[model samples]
Target: MRKEVPLLITILTAFIVILAFFLTPLAQTQQILLRWYAIIGGFAMFVGVWNLLKKHVFQVSRGKNTFYSLVLVLGFFMTFAFGIYSIVKYKDAFYINSPFMFNFNYVLAPLQSTMFSLLAFFMASAAFRAFRIRRLEAALLLFAASIVMLGRVPAGYALWHKLPLIAEWIMKIPSMAVQRGIGIGITLGAVGMSLRIILGIERPYLR
Candidate 1:
């Protein structure tokens, strides 16, 4: 009964959302449903956090990589504590230079930037291997990538007068067209997936 109820709600909600596009009354109902969805989503985030904490706490209790697990748990609590303090101390309008903001700027931002900076080396290595002129397409891709990379720098202008102009043309024309084409393809794929879900062919929610 529990599973069936959720499946029924999923199917019903999907149909209503679809109908909302064509029906005025349903559209108004859809707006209300959207607000409810937002509320549910906000609550779900807390549930997710609880689950994460429980999993990490279990790992620590089991003495499996206790240090890492403990760090994770501690980080989560510290962040949460700072967040609550910021909100309370500022009355929902946290100051830009608050303790929480400082932690985010000095700690979180650097960690995220450092992670991406480390990936740059791996990306360059991969690109070097992939950009090898093993075929016509590979050669073209390599040429385009090199031009784009050089165009982004002042050194490229110093090296050659027309290189940056050629790079700009390639980016505004071929790159933009390819990006738009991929976007359209993704939109079509999403629509098809939605239709399949509405028609019950894809019962992921039921699972």
Candidate 2:
């Protein structure tokens, strides 16, 4: 009974949503569904906050990595508090402009930037390791990569104007074609999976 009821609701909702998308007259129904989604999403945020609080409180109480746990809890609550304060008090400001902003901008921003910057070094190392002059295909790939790198920079343009033209062609033509093909494939796959779930053919979510 429990499984059947949920499945019935899912099928009904999916049908309504798809029908609303196709039928222009049912736009209001779609809007209502979107509002319901927002309400549910807001409630889910509260649940997430509760879960985060529970985990950190447990860690702090047990004295297991208590310092880091405290930092996590403090950061989370501080951000939440600032968000509330900004909404209630300074309603017109761009951001909260609280301690949260300072911490995020100064400390977290630099750390996050540094972490992402390491990716360039990792990519370089990986490329160096993978790059071998053993085959024609490898040579072509290397040549293309070198041209792309040179074309994007001022020094490369100064060295040769053809580099920029080649880079532009690669970026505009082949890159766009590949991107569009992947996007279409992904959209089709998503639609197929969604239909399967709506039809109750996929029920992994059901116990």
Question: Please, what is the whole-model Cα lDDT of each candidate in the order they appear?
Answer: 0.88, 0.85
Candidate 2 contains a number of clashing pairs equal to 0
| TM-score, per-candidate, Cα-based | 0.82, 0.80
The numbered model that scores best in TM-score is 1
Candidate 2, residues 13-132, lDDT tens digits: the string is 888888998999888987897899899999999999899899999999999999999999988877778666766666632364755566678878999999999999999988786676
In terms of TM-score, how similar is model 2 to the real structure? Answer: 0.80
Q: Which is the leading candidate under lDDT?
A: 1
lDDT of 1 by residue, 127-199 (tens): 9889875999999999899999898899999999888998999999999999999999999999999888776
Ten-residue region with minimum lDDT total, candidate 2: 92-101
lDDT of 1: 0.88
